[model samples]
Target: MRGEGSAASAAGGISGGDGGASGTVPPPRGGSRRGGSRRGGGPANRRGRRRVLRWVASVLSLLILGTGAAGYLYYRHLNGSIQTDALNLGETKLGGSKPNAFGQTPLNILIIGSDARNDAANQALGGATETFDGPPLADVQMLLHLSADRSNMSVVSMPRDTMLMMPKCTEANGTVHEASKGLVQTNESLSRGGPGCTVAAWTELTKIPIDHFMMIDFKGVVSMADAIGGVPVCVEQNVHSRTRDGKGSGLKLPAGTTNIQGEQALQWLRTRYGFEDGTDIGRTHAQHQYMNSMAREFRKNAKLTNPVKLNSLAQAAIEAMVVDPGLNKIDKLFDLSMELKKVPPGRITMTTMPWIYSTRPGLDGRVEPKAGEAEDLFRMVREDIALDGQGSGTPASAGSSPAPSASAPGTAGTAQSAPPAATAAAPAKIAVSVRNATGGKDGAQAKAKGRATEVATLLAGKGFTKAVADTQTGAEDTTVVRFATDRQAADAAALATALGLPASSVEKSGEVPGIVLYVGKDWRTGDAPPAPAPAPTKAPDSAHPLNGDNDKACMAIQPGFTW
Candidate 1:
């Protein structure tokens, strides 16, 4: 309920009236007054006019009643289709990140695509082969970010193989999980409790509060695609996916565009080996393309304006999803959609969490957070920064009202207002001191020893010759950079950029002697922070950039995937 009051109006609202233009009164022909001849005519003509009027009145009455009844029935049906789940992921604490200038805070939603094969039909879709009702892995996880002003949306997908420490979560049955100390696979969070647990894991990792979650199983994908009519996808070459043992998505398409729905849509999303490099990263890119195109299709088709299409879409989506109680209403979903649709396709972006191959032998083939780049992306979201540098707004009325800009992470303004001014001193010339506040005599880092010195060495290697370790220390949850004087603010900001720390983590401290850093538990092991993130206007090279309607873009097939 943190943002319930503003979620409706700030986000656009879709009126759910039946689609059609209102009937208009017609004018007389050739400047003649309507019914003038009938009025002047004899008794027979008058009688005829009276009969016609009666017939018209009767017909209009029936039409009105019929329309009202149909509309009510449809509304009830759509509402009934939705399934609700109490998001008993335990209490969520706000990260205290600043809202936009207008006092509107961002909304983060975790969408989970579960691989539960509970039914016979679902079992055929391919999942864990052992048991039908057994716990399932969260196959697809995407965090959708709605900007504070509702101007732009960013969908950040987390790979299933990525490892992270999950926060303790409470299940709907009143069971509680102790907070995990060791790094665990992210997908396991779902099995621990429910989709709420998945949300909790993310909250623990990013420190970003999640408002709600919408989860769907394998069958939901098929139903949703069918309801949306069809989503168009393209590929660069002919491909046929299959494995020697007959395990695969069974997807086959010629080297061009295809309108996929139902099973084909599921295949397109689930395909991995034939998509790009045959890794989860490659599959994630393909999913982004499908989603981007789907958004364009929804806008182009005008589902909200057409009652039939709208009802079908609403029913299909609702029936397919298990949502947090907060988002279980059709109106809420429509409002959320309208908010998202406000941003032009060009402004909406889809990116994956940066990751690296796991080195631990037991977890081989798995991936771990790429550290710097991943944190940088999360920080951008936490601050409500648009991925694209340009301001965002509704494409239909962008000329009339432009959206606020990505002035700085967690702020709004023109690009000119973004920080790290051109006159800031170079990194090498700026003095920096890092304190290992991860723990004390009996703390986690105490056993590791000399972590502050190690990080200082890492900083020195990055060209900050004056970088050194500090003696003062206390427990800190996240890493932060502080500067003593306003003059050194730019230098502190520069150092944060180099270390890939969020702009929110940089603060002014009058008591500090120089640019000082306190390395928190978040950075106990990394050699150095990730490279400075690209400006909002720029994207990391690894990201697959596509506008909402990138009709010309096509997925490239891997060598073995060629038909």
Candidate 2:
């Protein structure tokens, strides 16, 4: 099939190498099939299943050791089960990355939780019961960021309901899905061109190079949870999932912690109707907590040392995922997992992308990326800087020096390059016009009460006596210090120094009088702009910082979900 050929090409493996039972390049054992054996459940069938299990267990033992001494014995069987898909359109078509000081490149993988009921097992899991096979939704999307040195890991979630532009993508069959000039729900990318299109949407939005992707379906989720034994979750109060009218997830649990597995685990992940805020954002928090616990469990379980457990997990994980060709090999996945293991859980941080509720007509309840805030995150990731201050010796935390813009190097937070007149202006003599340009897609400003006046007041306290709040607020992509003429360039430079903006951002507008300090989304709420000088050793506070190992908090049950 065309799909199989595309997948095989993606894995970078030899063509026609070890095809699997599904008529695909790499097929899984019969036991990995969704339902029981196609043949009768006789004594011979039972014996066959036992032999396969035992053979798998022996192969896993050798793999966990990493010596590859006996790899040839099971390499074909394991490799054949993997399914690969195209990773990206092209690094050139999509902007690529920047290596760290060590010359090691960072890895960014898009983890997709696909709700694709393409067969009987998936259909039984639930969603639009009328059809046997339905279009897939990339419902739970998380971008897993691994630092170049593997010192830290960060996972950032994008809400499924976020409305954004999806770039044009080509499917396996050579059919191209055109870009939506207007906004569409982020999850729609999956149905358009499989998981590859979803990766394209992220690259377009963040401009961060996506190395690869791994997609799992409804059955995959259940199988994975079972293989891991169970994961721990918590709630602040007694919660019941089902609604009064029967539109709930059918999950009910008492207050405090619970070790949930299988169907119960699926419910915990899919119970958005009765969780905190009853929204996807709340569900994202729950997922982070679950992932953190799962990591801890893996560390504690020592599955690699136990042949049975290791084989079970390895088999389940392989059967559950469709990954990029680069990661299609058993050794490749093992190596990646080892790299991830190097980072301690305490160094891992999980956060949701900054976004605002949408008010666009017919798009109510959806969200759009919060412009300046989201870019700050994307820049950090692209530059290979750690959000938690634990990556390499160079920390990209709150107070770290901001990266210089690609267009203008050595302009970030440096005062030596400022214009002469900028040094001559006294603090009290610096007249500034503070404009609040933190408005929305429409003309509506953020409901932040008197934000312009507040910022101007802050400037006044800093000795800019003439700093007055502008009556009009507009939408701006980047914060800037603009001057009306070239004569005022020095003054703009001085103001940029005060606001920690790069000198490249200062420009002569030939319109606004004095220094027009257009406050973008970056400093919308802060009392003062980030200082240009070296930040204190202490880390800067992030918007929604989630510490993986240290957090033990439970979900606060919503009013409706409470029993």
Candidate 3:
């Protein structure tokens, strides 16, 4: 009922008849032309005019009827694409029930852009051969958080290079893998198990339950963009890049507003080397901007008022999306679309989960979130609160109530215990070093190390018997918690929560080869010994960068795999 006005109007336009709400009537046939001079017109001219009017009316009626039929067909197609089998009601995690300023329920959706090319259609898109290259990776991972009141939304992109514990996944092909036995890449989970595994990994890593998921791939994106004509985007500078397959997928645009469609839109989303940092994080911002621009264009364009175009866009979107089974239902999608329509583009915010680059001993360089930063982010969503500019928030200081904890042990307020059996592994012996990232002339670095030592001691108290505190480093402005291995990292997460540390304050890095606690300027030391400065690594630039070719291929194959 809240959206009845818009929904009714939209529906009326599709129904091939006027709703009478606009107060306009169809003109009477030949009334204006004939006027009072009907006698002045010859019989032949009158007949011809009448015939022409009748033909025009017939054509207009057919057009309206055709539009209505198309709309009905599109709605039916959308209903069919919903995968009921893919719905995991029990697995869905809702953020806290706290209402935002607008008093709406806040929702977080995990959008996965998979790289699997197992499907024939997907393989064709990526130009794949039959050499068992494994399914495509989930090159693009975004957590879209909508405010409780549905007035504000934020899309946070998680870098795939981010090193975190991957939950054991059960692939759609019926293959089961154990979490402890294998070291998995973040994006690989999508290929191994599908979106469900990706969801599990996210839940395990962030401790935040995902409510729904929407997956889209290349063709769908292209078609959808084309259907809406083209989306206008602003680039600060010129951008040029090639696709992974050595194709000329270069993006050439001036430093101004440009309307891009078809492959060009895809290219813009895929262009990395020409963008800032040349990382997936850079592309995330570009995509966010594109989405924002598209939303604005959609709202401003009266062409969508044409039932045919509206039906085309809707069909394209539905066909391209792979949704959780729970969302496959028409009623559910209808409700969601209605809710989404209420929120304007300006209200939507986009950001990347803040991260720092770190190099692992054997593994390649990876991006890691600053310590406790991710946790704080999750907590903000749980409490339906907006994050600060730095993605930092204090539960107590924010004056918001805490969210309900998972009934499972080790969650908020739950009895302190080990992680779930599926996630538990042998703890590793590791030393932690905490340093002040914020530059200061004072003994701030030492002070940060002291907090790190305190965290280390807290971990030791919580069954991480070998946890030891080490010295601080002169890392700039970012707080991070590094781990030696996947097992120790998961242990650290549990320990951090038990110690009442913010989740955002906890981070896991595969690079340090041991636990290192890096405290930011925001952290304070408690009753713990001050740690020593940590040994710096070798020349930082020598670290192995990501395989750019593989990365491009992974990006190109994403849209098809997910959809």
| TM-score (C-alpha, index-matched) for candidate 1 | 0.64
lDDT of 2 by residue, 1-563 (tens): 11111332212111111111222111111211112321233321212111111111221222232322233234435777888888754211232334443344567878887656576655544424433445666766778788765678777778777788777887778787877878888877887878888888887677677776777654444444565577788989987654443334445678999997655655565555456665556666776777677667765675345455445555555665678877777766655555565677787887788888777776655677886677677666666667777555442455654432211111211222212232437767878887877663344556355777988887787677888998866655456677775556676677777666765456544347667888776566786655433322212243365776854768877675576
Off by over 4 Å in 3: 1-74, 84-104, 130-133, 170-175, 181-183, 242-248, 388-563
The local distance difference test score of each candidate is: 0.59, 0.58, 0.46
Cα deviation of 97, candidate 1, in Å: 7.4
Candidate number of the best TM-score: 1
CA deviation > 4 Å runs, candidate 1:
1-73, 76-81, 86-92, 95-98, 119-129, 303-313, 392-436, 439-537
* Candidate 3, backbone clash total: 32
Alpha-carbon RMSD of each model? 21.4, 15.4, 20.6
Ranking by TM-score: 1, 2, 3
Alpha-carbon deviation at 437 in model 1, angstroms: 3.1
TM-score of each: 0.64, 0.62, 0.55
What TM-score quantifies how close candidate 3 is to the native fold? 0.55
Worst 10 residues of 1 by lDDT: 12-21
Candidate 1 colliding pairs: 372-530, 383-410
Question: Which residue segments of model 2 deviate by more than 4 Å?
Answer: 1-76, 90-92, 303-305, 390-543
